[model samples]
Target: MGIDLEKGGRIKKRNRTAPKSENPYLLLLVKLYRFLARRTNSSFNKTVLKRLYMSRNNQPPLGLGRLVKLSRKNADKIIVVVGKVLNDERLYHVPKMTVCCLKISDSARARIQKAGGEVLTFDQLALRSPKGSNCMLLRGPKHAREVYKHFAGVAVEGHVKPYVRNKERKLERARGRRPSRGFKRKPKKV
Candidate 1:
C-alpha cells in the first residue's frame, strides 16, 4: 500500500496523564472501581491495557505503529532481527532494540557502536530477555526463525509489504486520451 511514514514519527510518554473525565464507558468503570474501593475502604489497582500480540501470518500486527512509537521513547536497548542481512536503506531509520545485518560493514558497525548499541547475532537476539522488558524486533527476511528463538519478550516493528499498486500504468493510460499536435506536417504538393 502506501508508505508508513508514522513508524518512527513520535515517541511515547512513559507516564501518561489521562483525562480526569474521559470516555463515558471508562468513566463508568472508574466509578465502579471507586465504589468498590469505597465499600471496602481500601484502594485497588486500576486496570491497565498492557501488551497485545498479533499473529505473524500474512498481515502486519495491529497497533504495531503505536508500539514502535512507545519503544523509541522508553526502550533502553534495541535488537534488529533480519531474515538474511541488513542493508544501507534499512539502517537509515534505526529504531532502538534491533538486530539486523543488512550490510554489517565497518562503517555501519561503527555508527551503531557510536550510538551506544549492542550488536548480537541472529541466534543471540532470538534468546528472550527477562520480562518487563522493552525491545523491538525487526523481521526483514524469510530467515526470521534462526533469530526468533532467543527473545522471550519483544515489540515487533514495521508493516508487512502490502500488494503493490501500479500508479505509473494508471497515469500512462490516463495520458493517452489527450491528443498530440504534429509539427512535421508535409507541405501540399503543387
Candidate 2:
C-alpha cells in the first residue's frame, strides 16, 4: 500500500495486500504519538491527538530536541544500514563515530588506523554513546566496507550476518506451521 502525503497523513491503506512490515517512518511517528499519549495521560485534547496521528504520514511528530534527547538517552550501539551506496552526504564526514561490532579484518583495521579512527564493540558503543544521535551507522556488505574506505576517520563494527541468519530461521519456522493433511477432518453431510 502507498502512503499519501495528504488526508491528514494517517494510515490511509488498509487491505490484505498491504506490505507485511510496517513503514519505518510511520513506526517512528507512532512512537512519537505514544510518547505524547503517555505524557498527556488521557488528558490531551481529542483534536490535538487526532492531529498528531494525522500528521504522521509525511513527517515525524516530534521536533529535533526530542529526537536528540531520545537518541542520547536510549541508544548505545548505532548500526547504520545504508539503504543505497554512500554519497557526499555529511553523514559520513563526522569526526567520531560509535559502532556496534568489531569484526573488521586486519586490512580493514589497518585502513581505520590510517584514518585515525578506532573500532569498538556493541557494548562499548552503548556504554559510550546514545542510540539515535549523530553517530552514523553504516550497513551493507562489501559495499558498506568500500564506503568506509573512502572516509579518513570513520570507525566500523558490527556483523549483521548473524542477525540475518537468525531472521531466516524465524521465517522458516513460520512457514513450517501449516497443518498436515492428516490433521484435516472430513466434512459431515447436512
Candidate 3:
C-alpha cells in the first residue's frame, strides 16, 4: 500500500488597494482618481490613486525649503504632492513654481504666492493636466518620524532609543547601562 499525504490549502493574499481614510474630501479625491485611472492610460493617475490609499504615516509632510530645492530645475512644471506642505523658515528665498497638494500651511502658501507662484487644488490640477503632464510629483521622507528612532529588531548598533519615563540620572540608570551596577556591554570595535 502507498502512503497518502495531506495537502494544505492556499492562503489568501491581503488586499492592499483600499484606503483607510474616512474623510469625505479625501474620498472624493479617491473617486476622482479612480475614474481618471480607469479612463486614462496615464501611470501618474494610478500612482496618485495608490498614494491616496496610504496611511497618514506614509503621507509625510513636505517642507517648503526642500520643495524649492527640488523643483528649482522644473520651474515651469506644477508640483503635485499627496501630502501637506509646511513652511520652512530656513529657506530665505522661495522660488516661483506652481504647487498642487492636498494641504498647504498658511505661511507656505503666502511664501509661494509672494514669489509669483500659484497654489492649485487637486480638482484644478485634474482639469489642467488629466495625464499628469507638465507636473512633478514629490514625496517627503517617510522614515523621518520621531517614533522610528525607537524601532527595534534591527542592527541599529545602540542608535535605537529606549522609551524612558524621565531623563533624570536616578531614572533608567541601572544594570546593562552602568558597569558599577553589573556587567556592561563593551563597545563594538570599528
Candidate 4:
C-alpha cells in the first residue's frame, strides 16, 4: 500500500524576487542589486534588493526630524531609506549628514543642502557603496496609520479609540462613560 501524503504536506509560497515598479530606472537598480546580492554574498545587498521589491504603501515615508533623532549617534555613516523623505516643519534645526532615498520633497532637499548635508539618489549611493558599507538602513513607522486606531476589540481598555459615526451630544457619549447614565464600573486599582 502507498503511504498517505495529502494530510501532512503543504507547499510553501515564495515571495517576489524582483521589484514590481514599472519605472526603467527602478528596474535598473533592481537588476544591479540582484547581481550584487548573488555575486558579493553580502546580507546588506540582499536586504536592499528585498526592500526594492516592496510596494509604495509598504515603503512608508520617513520624516527628517525622526531621521535626525535616530541617526544622531552615527553621523559619519550614510542613512539609506527605500521610500520618500519628507520635511518636518516642526524641526527647527537640520543636521549635517549624508542621506540617500528614492525620493525627497523639495523643501527637504533644500533644507539638507542648506545645512551642509548631501542628499543622494539610490544610483549615486550604489556607485559609492555597492555592498552597503558605512551605511545605516532605516524605515518609517509602519503602524502609524489612523486606521490602526479602531483595530482593538470593543470596550477594551488601553485607550483604543472607538469608531463613531459622528461626534454629537447623544451619539457614543453615555452609559460606560458616566455614572449618571445607569451604572459605572469601579476603576481598576493598580
lDDT ranking, best first: 3, 4, 1, 2
TM-score versus the correct structure, for each prediction: 0.29, 0.25, 0.84, 0.81
Put down candidate 4 lDDT per residue, 1-190, tens digits, no spaces. 6544554334355567677779998999898888889989789889988999998877999999999999999999999999999999999999899999989999999999999999998889888998899999999987677776677643236456777898564666667656787756677753
Best candidate, TM-score-wise?
A: 3
Kindly indicate the candidate among 2 and 3 with the higher TM-score: 3
Q: What C-alpha lDDT do the candidate models reach, one value each?
A: 0.37, 0.37, 0.88, 0.86
lDDT of the structure predicted as candidate 4? 0.86
If the candidates were sorted by their TM-score against the true structure, best first, what order would they fall in? 3, 4, 1, 2
Candidate 3 matches the true fold with a TM-score of 0.84
Clash totals for all candidate models: 23, 6, 0, 0
Off by over 4 Å in 2: 1-102, 141-190
Clashing residue pairs in candidate 4 (N, C-alpha, C atoms within 3 angstroms): none
Candidate 2 global Cα RMSD: 20.1
Candidate 3 local lDDT, 113-185, one digit each (tens): 9999999999899999999999999999887888888886432564678789976656667776688878676
lDDT of 2 by residue, 1-190 (tens): 8756554357567322222337665355345535554555443222222432432222222222222233454344343321222222222222222333324345433443444555565335433542334455433333334344445454334212222345453453344333442233344443
Residue 143 Cα positional deviation in candidate 2, in Å, after optimal superposition: 11
How far residue 12's Cα lies from its native spot in candidate 4, in Å, is 6.8
Candidate 4 TM-score versus the reference: 0.81
Candidate maximizing lDDT: 3
